[model samples]
Target: MEEDTDFRIRFSSLCFITDHVGFHGTIKSSPSDFVVIEIDEQGQLVNKASDEPIYKVNKMLPEPNNLAKKTKLDRQNLSFEERSNQELSTLAGCSDGDQIHAPGSEKEDTIKDGTSEGEEGNIDVLGSLLDEKTDELLSQFACDVKERWDSKTELIGPSPEFSLGRILDKNQRTILHSAIRQKFPFLVTIGKNSEIVVKPNLEYKELCHLVSEEEAFEFFKYLDAKKENSKFTFKPDVNKDHRKAIHHFINKKFGNLVETKSFPEPNYSADNPSVVITVRFREKAHKHRKRSLLECQERKVIYTAFTLRKENLEMFEAVGFLAIKLGVIPSDFSYAGLKDKKAITYQTMVVRKVTPERLKNIEKEIEKKRMNVFNIRSVDDSLRLGQLKGNHFDIVIRNLKNQINDSANLRERILEAVENVKNKGFVNYYGPQRFGMGRKVHTDQIGLALLKSEMVKAVKLFLTPEDLDDPVNRAKKYFLQTEDAKGTLSLMPEFKVRERALLESLHRFGMTEEGCIQAWFSFPHSMRIFYVHAYSSKIWNEAVSYRLVTYGSEVVEGDLVCLDEDIDDEHLPSSKVHLVTEEEESANTYAIRQVVLPVLGYNIQYPKNKVGKWYQEVLNRDGLQTCRFKIPTLKLNIPGCYRKILKHPCNLSYQLIEDHDIDVMKEGSYIDEATLSLLISFDLDASCYATVCLREIMKHDF
Candidate 1:
């Protein structure tokens, strides 16, 4: 009898309770009308003369047929803060007494004698009982971010541009799901009180279609449900938090690509005795670990790790300058890959026969250059590009407000995001690092200009500083823009060595446009190659985006599939992409494990289908042809290469740490008191980026 009575009470409440009851006018509610109250961040309720928590009486509407009716009043009086414009629009065309069907309710035809057939309607369902204001805030925030990134991409970058919606969807699927499931995608130990338990309402999806405007509405409610149930308190709208986390992840990871060169495996004669053979993957079932002895002498290679703190220089530039200071040429120095200057990057570098004393002095000199060498050791071989197995990154992301203080629910939500990423990894489009992070001018743009023989434009864009905030660089850029090449040479700063060299060449050749072209070629071979590579990388990124959106992970006929995982090595400066044959294409027995796309070059043979058509279309849209990649003027006959359609970071790990843990004081950086941060660490194979891993985590497009 008691259970029956409880059910009756619940059923009665459900019939009358609507999540967003429209108010007739601007009248505010007294504290007596609300059963419970919570304060907003501004600590204001009703602004006229309010000190107490003024509540809005959820003005209940009378039920008409299945739909609720708003009180007779002009909606024109409604303020932005109190308006539900979308909801109001749904109630249009219905007269005062006409029958109306509520959202998720069965049509009159579908319902017979007050009983619906098939699944029951979701009217007044538990999942629908979310705070409308919070839902609106979250959704609006998400939409704004998506629109912003999309607009920015349309202006300066390649087409098939970055999609903020797709990124958010990916993040929601990967990171968020993992966190909620309490399962890390890659294995790791959990921190204290990291998990939050909650029951999800599975019936919500059937009730109504999630609209584009309400992209984040359901997520906000999902978090709100826990708060209402007193399971744990978390902010209903985490838009700010989401943005910070996304941008932070982007700045740290997805901002760069690691380009390397391919070389043959080391060969040694059997007579040599100093070399030892090591098994890469040993079986645990074996009685004893097996090993093979190889004959070779250890090369004098000094492996050193350095942290770059400034953003003004690229990795190769810093290493080259360091070599010059050490009285040796840059050719004497070798490194696995270049690290990003925009970050506090720690990476390995190798130099032969450099004494410990000299290396220590070099380290001290680097400190003056806003860099620090933290580790140095002797290795048996020279560290060629892509020699290292992978890079392990420990990144500290700051200024996230959503998860600040005791926001356990926010943390739980983040964990959920992380969980989503763990199950199915993200699409690995090359980050902004593959192309330079210039606002008006990108490296790929300059490269494309070079390919099209737009030397004057390329030279101008190159001299135009990416960071306009720097007055010195900005002034120098202005001089280059307003003055002739001859005059600009005198105005160029001493540090603007590349720009000065180009200007000098122009002046030397009578300030003619041909001199500008020759001047561009005079830069370091490493730097010149980078521009062409950037163009190729951009094509690869765009192709990957198109492939994932159209065909997804499934393989189709005429698709150029990669036969081996090692196909990524073909991306090396010296190699090219090799697609499977028609016989292989005919055999559909193999799983669609890897799809590789080609970077444009004369040697590139595009897939003979929609994929190939897309490649031609993209090139055509850029007003160029694949043959242009073999330009004689630039001497850049960059061969086509392959990039894996998807990348999953290996050994991924992350933890949300306190701001106090970061040493911002050393750099005189001031962190917001309300900010929360994350310390994410992960490892990626050579040429695979840590930023890509972060993209999987945060899902922010730009």
Candidate 2:
């Protein structure tokens, strides 16, 4: 065959490992011509065949009780003192003397009547400040908080704040604080400048630790110095035992951010020192720290896992259609990886919060859409990308007579190619799908623009016309000429989702630099990352080609090799590899097939040889530095990984079929009666592109 000069080959690599003559043929002539079966991490084939029953809700795991709703109902039925004692018991994990008193309770009435042992001289001096109207308003506020607490329904406006007129005497202020705490323990009272203010308590208690009032005050002062928000406060005075109980309550209810500490009153002459406790932020507290204990308790099997078989449908398109039918967003669905759009593929899929019955009911609609789902079951965890072991391919290459002389020649060529692959393997270069097919502007170009922090250029490259006559192309051309996003959007088809989204965002946000960047970001995270990953793949392909040309099939001194021979998955990150040392290479510990090349990223180590220097040359040619991998503005951090230089397909096999033996060929079809076809079947590790393998076998541009 003449030297291939395709742009994709130049962009990636044109190197082929095997020297055997490759026969020409066409693959994916029909949807049935290509087949893919996903293999799960357990080494089990994820195919359409399943013995599991049709999804039913009864077959799912039982759900836990709704504790929040039950608690809300119980709180509504309890009296003020009963509720306080109950909450204290449940939250503090204690009872008895820990109970808080309500107003008019025996303890409070005794203090009010000047009949208590220690408070005989104390009287209700602040009685004039507490009018019946004030008491009613405070009670109403408490009721509102109670009703909305469990459900987290937003309270209208801000929390209600009650202001008490200045009381000159400390004893009178203390009396008022005690009265409020006894009546509404959920409310917090703050005393400043002889004035008292009361509001509903909304404190956090994560990582609680005791600190003195002075320490708490100093921490707030430090925050003021740094101009940070002081999200902490001191609580009203309480007895020593009550302070300890309050600490437990704060820890259990608020989760450790807020802490309680009791200290002696300054310059007190009494035999027993008065105790004052304060709640304040920890020294370096995070506002939204994850609590593993709470997460474990809340985790449940709310996701449904099933196998989906799709024909001639893109993964995203299939997922989007299912999401619409299931009344859920596309984000609710998760899969191991994307499959070929033109092939019949069977892969595992997961959907969150959808019942098995709901999934089963959509079977008819799914079948109408040329898709099948089976083996539905409830799983605690959702399927994640790169979770599969590999994929099994059953591909048919037809029309081999156009290149081969006869059936014998085709069979001999295919057998030689398969055998060569089984032994020497083929270069693991990225396929055309990574850069997109038949597009004027490749995805890698946009990725390069993004890495350069040229958002406008990236956006323009993305919107560049792929064809001169297609409706989507026309719309893109119109926008490029006039920059009228609204007008262009009207001409764009709804099926062109990413294009429509970019136009919609631009129409709303205008066509400024920030707007263009925002429009670029409007694409889904996977779509955005795919472009950058494509660029990385391109560089990786060229590097692998260079390594092969410079060092042939030799295990070089500075090459990186996989440390674990048992690691069947090639999709593992760079952490699995290490540089081959002189000692290891001398001992022949690692083979050339075990060598790995770096994907361009910030978090990877390049080869320690001249091949590493070649990477820098490639990056410089593309106007990129390693620092560009860490784009903080776009939040695009590419942690570069490693991929093996070559891959040997597992269970490789092939057969030559004549036109008469082909079931799909019709009697009066235009195809030649003596046409030869090759049936190829093989298994590849995760992240290995099957099309690249086919390229090695056929030496044809797809």
Question: What's the distance in Å from true for residue 520, model 1?
Answer: 2.3
Candidate 2 at 285: error in angstroms? 24
TM-score of 1: 0.49
TM-score of 2: 0.63
TM-score for each model: 0.49, 0.63
- The superposed Cα distance between candidate 1 and the true structure at residue 397, in angstroms, equals 2.8
Backbone clash count, each prediction separately = 22, 10
User: RMSD to native for every prediction?
Assistant: 39.1, 17.7
lDDT of 2 by residue, 349-426 (tens): 888757677789899988988999988877666777788988999999887743444345545676777788788888
Candidate 1 local lDDT, 1-702, one digit each (tens):
011121011111111101111111110022111111111223321112322312222112221221122211111111111112222222111111221211222122111111211112222221143246633443354354345543653323421111112222322222322232121111111111222112211112211122222432333232212222122112222243333332222211111111111122245334331222111111122233444422111211233332233333566667656655655434456665666555544444555445434666766767767655533444334445554455555565544434223343445455665555555555555556666543456778777777777787777667766555564465456656664665676555655545655665554444446656556644644566678777777777666666665665566666666656664444433233345555665665344446667777766677766778898887787778545576565555676666666566555676655556654232334445345566555555556655555545553322
Model 1 lDDT vs. the true structure?
0.44
Off by over 4 Å in 1: 1-313, 327-334, 350-361, 373-384, 401-409, 465-471, 482-490, 571-592, 626-628, 660-675
Candidate 1 lDDT for residue 606? 77
